[model samples]
Target: MFFLKYLPTQSLILNYQEHFPDGAEPKIASRLEMLREASLLLRDLEDFFRAHDFSLTRFLICVILDRADEQGGLQHSEIVERIDVSSPVISRSLKSLIDERFVCVESETEGRRTKRNRLTDAGKARLQSLMPGYYEILLK
Candidate 1:
């Protein structure tokens, strides 16, 4: 019983091959299949991130912050371009991180409506803690 529950995901993936015919499955896989791969891989990371009080948006914001340009922050517009997420989507994410003291926002010089965002020390620390597990799955 314990063995049944302990099977690794990699093992299950290997076994899924039996359901398909020989040389029939796309070796390179399609875009939809790639999306499926992303979905499955994210499941493990999502559980880990959730333990750290992160949603996918929050986790993605951390990634954005980590890759920010000159100001150690990115403009809201820039973040949307890089992540392909909507402004409202990132707005909610920024709010959560801000409330948690994991990030800060600065009004743009040009206008109050525009804002730049950066990760806080706490956010970086949390990201550091979560990195190893994230890296392990991503590298697989």
Candidate 2:
């Protein structure tokens, strides 16, 4: 989301006419409007997730796991790759989800230290519950 909730007014954009070449003004105005609308959309998504006791990150994780092999879910490193976030943050969130009984991990091999993360039945249910609200937020 945009750090500045208060975007510049149209008059302020108009004032930039003197600084730019002739036709560039309209392009600049269009870009600003796009950014402003995108920012508002992101904020709405954030709020909707928060109200449902969920986080976007967690929801993304669930979505990824939903497509993984049923017998074994995605590896931690795989999730990190898919989400493009720091491993520590993924680990922390995974830990929380495990504690909440929303997720489980299985050792990949007898002696291997690696584990795969999978959503428990409860986790799947929770994700299912959130989908409708999430869709409404977008379509509305």
Candidate 3:
């Protein structure tokens, strides 16, 4: 069970509680409220990325690629682990990025069979463009 020291979301809690059975636990109701709030925030963030013509996953890949060393790139497994996403999700995002000229596969191999990835100049620029607004939101 998740516990918060202070829950300042009274209206949200009330709304969520109304849908549950009469004797539902307060903890469950509050958890639902928190989940609802998180979902809304995530949706807004996704919409912001979409407005810039990029999905959230693709934007994240650009960030990861941009942070790699000048002469090194991230391997497919590295990206999957760092992003905490499934293989197919990372694969699709990488494919979209490659098609958009935002990312590329480096010829250099990490090990026996690992293919490395790096961001193109276009990807760096795109990330830079979004950074100001992103930072503003975070700072607030």
- Top TM-score hit: 2
For residues 49-105, could you state the per-residue lDDT of candidate 1 as single tens digits? Answer: 787667767877787797773566988778788786788998888888889988888
lDDT of 3: 0.78
- Residue ranges of candidate 3 with Cα displaced over 4 Å: 1-33, 109-113
lDDT of 2 by residue, 1-140 (tens): 55556667777877878988878867887887788777777788889889987788888888888878575898988999999779998888788888988888988999899888889999999889999988887786
Please give the TM-score that candidate 2 achieves against the real structure. 0.80
How many steric clashes between backbone atoms does each model show? 0, 0, 0
Score each candidate by Cα lDDT. 0.73, 0.84, 0.78
| Candidate 1 vs. true structure, TM-score | 0.67
Model 3 CA lDDT for position 105: 85
Q: Write the per-residue lDDT of candidate 3 for residues 1-140, one digit (tens) a residue.
A: 23344555656666767676865657776666777666655666677788888877888888888888574879888899889789999999999999988888876735555578999888888889988866665454
For candidate 3, give the lDDT of residue 112. Answer: 52
Best by lDDT: 2
Model 2 segments more than 4 A misplaced: 3-24
Give lDDT: candidate 3, residue 72.
82
* Candidate 1 Cα deviation (angstroms), residue 137: 1.9
